[model samples]
Target: MSRAAVPRMLLRGWAIQVKDSSSFGFFIMSSLIEPVIFAAIAAYMFRAGNRPDALLYAAIGAGMLGVWIVTLIGSGQALTFLRHAGILELLIVAPVPFVLVLAPITLAAATVGMYSLAATLVWGWLLFDVPLGVEHPWLLLASVPATVIGLGMLGMLMASVFVLFRHANALTNMLGYPVWLASGFLVPVSLLPDWVRPVSWLLPTTWGAEAIRTSMIGGHPLPAIGACLGLAIGYFALAALTVRHFERLARQRASLALA
Candidate 1:
């Protein structure tokens, strides 16, 4: 790839995502608003006596949920739509890496997902009077990009896996909320079944939420940050290998063309 290729591909992906207002509206509603609403409900229902801290926790968890939604739902459905429209086949033949194409779409979705973070923070503070104080605001800020990178990699990995399926959207819906549940967003990892903790440890959502909370509540964020970056790299590598394998399979079997 040329030095400029990656940036160009990223811009192309961003532009495509932002081009249609109708589609963007759907992204906003599904990824941003819905997650915040879910969080508010969770906070209300689970509020150990209407405590601000508990509500704040739920708010942050909701923001993290947005991260998952934008990446998983966004990439899963985008790839499925591309396949339906016969664009996936064209991209497979394109000189740029197919993962590169998938990446920016995920990035764009994550960009939009920022609204969730902001909305949760503001909504919690304004509506519930949850204080917005962070013990280490800088760490909280830093976690944003780390979360995006980790989520983006996970999304790319999922896109690679999902590209092979015609019912990718349904598969995405099946996987999205379950991942959030296991992510320890609303529930503590300690309270989850022992079997689920190990799996949660491997997910970026687990680390992302941990990083955010630790930063907000005044704990060292290195552990959570390390987990997120490390797992992101692992997922990215797996995605590279898996995407190549699937591309070859698509080419040989012509499964990508059937849809």
Candidate 2:
């Protein structure tokens, strides 16, 4: 994995995904415009007078949610789609690794997500006077990549389920919604019911949001960055196990089908 080869792999992945115009159109609608619209409504409804910090919180929250959408929607759905289309088999036969084959789809989604984040931030600043300067610049940038890797891994895990199951799309959708709600996408975790609070603690998005919030807004410290990092690593590990299990099952099923 030379640095130069990375871009080529990603480019190959990107070229394959854009072959479908419908997917590209849906990507724009779901990944770009929808997030900005939601953020605008949130900024309007939660407008504050002197609480600049709160606005920053809102912006970061909204932005991070956009990023999550890319991983959750794009990676998960693309995997299922490819499998059903029989392209997954072709990709498996390619020279690139499985992860590389998935990279362009995720990256394409991430690009849209970033655009949505930028739109939300601009809208927040212009319409609601939300401050956009980073209080902890390094922490803010570091959290972006970490959060992406963490969520991307989880998406891959969910995508793997599609290999062995007929209704993994529904399962992915079910898993995605609870994470968005419980992880404080539109509301703070503190506002959730007492019993739900504990469940929220178990979600990776909760730690991700906390890390991003702490980084962007100059407020209370998170439990520990290391703890958040550990949680993310654990998530990746679990997803990897799930992927391996499903891959083995897929191979067995294919052999049986041939026989």
Candidate 3:
């Protein structure tokens, strides 16, 4: 691809997603509703006296959790729908690179995930009076894009993995909550079992949650930001390789047509 090719593809991909989302009232409504509900519930649960800290933690955790879950599910569902509608093959055979097409759609889904962040902050402040007082405001702002891009890459990785499955939608939906739980977004990694901590550490969500929380509560964000950025780049690289490998296998097995 030329220098301008990827940028043009990204803009087109993002526009397509925006148009589709606007055309479908369900997407627009659900994107607004889900995050607000989740954040409100979490805020309510932690609204008891002498728990400003807990409430703040809940707000950020719940928000990030919503982002992760939405991006994961949305990305997988987008791919599955494309397969069912016989569009995945066309995308793969398109003139531009497939990752260029896929990445923007996932990022667009990540854009919806921003609503989760907004809803959490809004409801937390409105209902619970949770103070925003983030010490490292710039760091917190920086972490937002890093978190979204990291999670988008995670979704891209999942897309590659799901391409081989016939009932990818079911698996994608089923895995959403479990992945959030394992990421320890709502809870600290220290609370998880010893065996699980290692796995959680490797996840982008873990690094992302830590980064955001650290930025919010006041701490050095370099470690967390570094891990988040590093892992996101790593995931994107792996996703590209996985997609290439899977495409080859699909062609050999004559299964790309089936999806």
Candidate 4:
């Protein structure tokens, strides 16, 4: 694809998403509300006696969790809806690259996720006086593209499964809770069972959360940064391959009604 065409494709995808404001609002609000509630409770509970940093840590956790969950789950559901509507097939037939076809849907989901993070941060600061700082501004800056590519690839991987099984939506929902729990957003990873720690390492959310936490909180160098970045890049590479494989399968399996 031409460099100029990329933005056009993204804009077109975004425009299609914005046309459905009610669904978008519902999707955004649903993801935001629960995290806000949990953050408030965690802040209050952890900050009850002393330790001002407790609220900050709680807010950080909540914000990271909010973005992670919204992007993964929202994008997966959006992709499934688009596929059911036959938009995925239509887009594949378009001149744009397959990856660009998923952009608009992923953008919509990421927008919702970022909005949720902003809301949580604002609410935490205003209500609890939680203070947040970026100790490693450069690292934090690098994380934005890393997160977008990593999570976008994850969403594509999940979406591809729908091509093989109509019931993959159930799988997304099933995996969502466990993925969230494993990411240590609600609790610290150090507290997790030893056996589960290895599994958590395999999840993108874990790396994303760690990166955010390390950047926001000043403690020590983030030992997981290299691992996180490497794993995220690898995951996206695999996701791209999966998208191609599934797109071909989808084309072959399309019937009159499916089309």
How many clashes does each candidate structure show, in the order listed? 0, 0, 0, 0
Q: Write the per-residue lDDT of candidate 4 for residues 1-259, one digit (tens) a residue.
A: 6898788878876666645632665666655787788788778778785655677677867776667667766667655676567666577787776766765676556555655566777888889777756788777766554555456556666665554666665765677667767888767777877888889888766776677667767643355566666775676677678778877776677641252
Taking the tens digit of each residue's C-alpha lDDT, what string does model 2 give over 1-259? 5668888877765656545422577666665677777776666666744444466667766766766676667767766677656667777666666665665665455445555567677878887777877778787676655555555555565566554555655665676557777888778778888777888776656766777677767553345345556665676667667765755776677731221
Using lDDT, rank the candidates from best to worst. 1, 3, 4, 2
Clashing pairs in 4: none
User: Compared with the true structure, what per-residue lDDT tens digits does model 3 show for residues 1-259?
Assistant: 6877778878888768756654655555455566667667666666654554688888887777677766776676666767777888888888777777788877777767766777787888887788888889999888878877887888788888886778877886787676677787666667767888878867888888788888988888768888888988998999899878877887788787675
Give the top-scoring candidate (TM-score).
Answer: 1
TM-score of the candidate numbered 2? 0.77
Global local distance difference test of model 1: 0.79
The candidate 1 region of ten consecutive residues with least summed lDDT is: 15-24
Please give, for residues 46-91, the per-residue lDDT of candidate 1 as tens digits: 7656554588788888887877777777766666767777788888
lDDT of 4 at 108: 59
TM-score against native, each model: 0.89, 0.77, 0.88, 0.83
**Ten contiguous residues minimizing lDDT sum, candidate 3:** 21-30
Give the whole-model CA lDDT for all candidates, comma-separated. Answer: 0.79, 0.64, 0.76, 0.67
